[model samples]
Target: MTHLRAGLVQQPAWPDKQKSLAASAEGIRALAADGARLVLLQELHATHYFCQTEDADLFDLAEPLDGPTTTCLAALAAELDIVIVGSIFERRAAGVYHNTAVVLDGKKGRVGHYRKMHIPDDPGFYEKFYFTPGDAAQQEGLGFTPVETSVGRLGILVCWDQWYPEAARLMALAGADILLYPTAIGWDPDEEGDENQRQLDAWTLIQRSHAVANGLPVMVANRTGHEAAPDQSSAGIRFWGGSFIAGPQGEFLEHAGEEPTTLITDISMARSEQIRRMWPYLRDRRVDAYGHLTRRYID
Candidate 1:
């Protein structure tokens, strides 16, 4: 039975970049000691969630592909001998930026990256102010393909992309054995208790559904803590860090609480194959009749 030990580092980003990187590196080292071959860090793990407000100066947070953040991750991956998926706010060019995930192979160093395609712009998540939507051409140009690592083919996606079934299906079709989401989502402090729970439940349910639908194991790493607004115009977000790994059947293999922690679990590639064979949802898909999906609406 082929198995892979995966690790998730769930923690809040600090105001200091070096401190946050140090924390993440420590978690990776611990997981490596426990035999985790692949580890994932949360979105923008090097710094605080800066998207809470839109400030022109915030663009400084974006770094180049070969910037300090990726440089540190690459060196850590090499030292720990673990495949690390680290998210970054990429400064693609002077004015162009993106929410990107860099995959560093332990032996190969910086291998490839996945530019986030879905850019969300809500009250709290003002991503549009900082990112340019990644298209197929840009992805191809940057080699944003499923990275083949020691564990399996990794279909790495950022936070907002997890909400789209189309993205999951595409990755599965492209031969990804597992799905990974590096996220930094939180609850609006203004919402009621029930509403907060509902939002969290929905987030978990949708991701689990992706696992079941695609017949692949799903891993998520989310930040945890309350990051206050700098200007205090509104209540800040409380990051709900329920980092978890779910099986191909949407069963929870391992789960974490709303605190800083490292979660390590072994997933069976053989089981994923068996489950997919038994379900056969992909074999029964009616692709010929789904051309309308490309249209904005059927009207």
Candidate 2:
């Protein structure tokens, strides 16, 4: 483990898959030019917030594991000698799809994939309709699994998955060296005061806590800008941008705000090792008594 340069692509996405792909490719290319060795794209980088509506035709967007999108990204990774982590919609079969993050290593290796486990079903976020609940490896089925890349073992979890401490801990226990999340979260464009601040604070605090609890570096790349639905007149979700990188102690290294940009940060794997040694939370575990965590409530 040593110091390395990593990147986050935080651009506002589009409804057209081709345009979104091109937009993000530009960011990745610029980051590579900046000498980034690992690039993390925001969740579902090649589409808008389609999870908002669950039309059946949206299924067309889902691709096979080794689809055209992966082909392009693979070529990009090999050309730049940089690892690329992209969130994709994987069409498993006729009607099954998973919210997956596929890792393309520098050598063009299809490193691995992790489906999003904690799917959220909120007002603006209706993921349950499109995503098959991840059969995370920590459990029993083929859910979210952290991916390994040339930089390190990446604990890739999606947006809603970041809220759960258990999610991050399980990945760490399973040998993940870094915690990564590709997100799409924001406020309603009409939010005026304290309520908006609270939401943003909670979002940042929770993710930073993941790093604090696990003693690992955390990267959260989010979408920027606002996209309006065709017929809806309500305040659309204003993706607050603010893509960030946090150290083991939950210190912010770099963060981008409500704008289209790519952020490059220095990831010190050595620093994380040192923090883990001092904290030693992983060493002082009560794994034997943690079975109750599996249940919703312990009576």
Candidate 3:
């Protein structure tokens, strides 16, 4: 019976890179102390939600894949002998950038990275301006590019990617044992009461649906806090951090609050196989008839 104890690190992020990274390290250490074999960090954990305002200055925050942050995480994961999943701001090149997830395998070094494919260009999130879409097809986007860590294959995805069923399906099909999402999303300050609740509900429902559809466990670690728009300073985003884990059949396992938190939960690897055998949805899929999925509309 292979089992894993996973930790979700949900914490507030400031506008300072140094402080935020240090805080994440400290939080990770604390979770490791609690006997977590793997820990997941929130999206863009290094700094505030800079996408609030599109500015050329923010590009300085981007760094090479082998730069300071990834370097430190490599050493940390190795030292702790635990798997670490981190979302980072990557400067792929001068003009090329991406919102990517870095999987630091303590046993194997820097294994790989996943570039965010679904870049949301909404009011608060201006990711499209900053990120070059992975450009890879859905098959390449979320097909369980595991880090081959100390424990097992770590299937990690970014925030916006969670909404697309194709992404999650590809991960499960690629033999991912667990699904991890490092996220940053919340209610708009201008939105009213019920609207905020509705948004949060939809976010939770969509991710859980992915878990249920794929018959695999899912974990989400989100940031919490209201970061002022750097330019306006008057209004900003209130990150409603409701991090959680869902089991096969979309069962709610454990949920974190709308605040800074670190939680660990045990998962049974066999359950994935057991559930899949019973449901058999993946086996019954009509892949040959899925061409219509590519179309924007039936018309």
Candidate 4:
């Protein structure tokens, strides 16, 4: 019965980079003290959720792959002797950026990273304007590949990618031991209460389904608090921080409230193998008949 203790940091971030990073560092330290071998932080923890509005100057917030955020997390992973997964706004080249999740092993520094494949351009979440969708051509087959770390093979994905089961399935098929999502999701402050609840419920339900289908544990870390738009064009988003961990059978291991929190739990890695034997979804898959999955539409 192999067990891995994992920690998730869900917190509010401010516009100030230094203050925001300090808050995240504090949570990482606390989790490490509690004996967590792996810690996952919310998306864009080093700064505010600036995607509320598309500003040309906001690109200034983008950083290189080995920039300050990765540097800071690598130091913490080394000092605490733990594996850390974090998200960053990556500046790949001039006028090209991506929403990337980075993984660091204890003393190994930056192990690998996954650029977000699904880019969303919704009312409040204007992500497509800033993030170029990750392409297999650009990464040279690294797209959707799980990162190998001391703790386990991390199937790391970003915020908007959480809604797609194909993304989760691809990671699972590629031999990911566990799935992790670093997210910045929330409700529109003006929406009716019932509608907001439905959205939140759907978000939780979809991710849990991934765990059950793949026979793996799923960890999600979301930011909390309300963030106003830079231009004040509309009512801002109230980030619902329901960070959680679900087991292989879609059972909740730990679930958090809307407030900022640090959640920790031990996941039974062997449970996945045991459950896969009982439910054998992989053995029953009809892969030969699903060739049209690559098509844009079946028309």
> Which prediction has the highest lDDT against the true structure?
4
TM-score leaderboard ranking: 4, 1, 2, 3
| Pairs with backbone N, CA or C atoms under 3 Å apart (clashes), candidate 2 | 134-143, 135-142, 135-143, 136-143
Tens-place lDDT digits, model 3, residues 86-166 = 878999888999888888878676777788878899887888888887656434333345445666766777899989988
How far residue 19's Cα lies from its native spot in candidate 3, in Å, is 0.9
* Better candidate number, 2 or 4, judged by TM-score: 4
Q: Candidate 4 lDDT, tens digit per residue, 1-299? A: 39999999999999998899999999999999999999999899999999999899999999999999999999999999999999899999999999988898999899999999999999889999999998764242268888989988899889888999999998999889999999999988888778999999999999999999999999999999999988998789999999999999899999999998899999998998999999998999999999999999999
Candidate 1: the clashing residue pairs are none
| lDDT (10s digit) by residue, model 1, range 149-238 | 766789888899999998888888888889999999999878877888998999999899999998999999999999987768679899
Residue 34, model 3: lDDT of 84
What's each prediction's clash count? 0, 4, 0, 0
lDDT winner between 1 and 3, please give it: 1
| Pairwise lDDT winner, candidates 1 and 4 | 4
Ranking by lDDT: 4, 1, 2, 3
lDDT of 2 by residue, 1-299 (tens): 48879998999889888899898899999999998998999999888988776678888989998897888788889888899998889998887789988899987567888888888997777788999877745542244456667788889889999999988998888778889999989887777799999989999999999999999999999998887754484667889988999999999999887889999988898887799889999999988999889899978
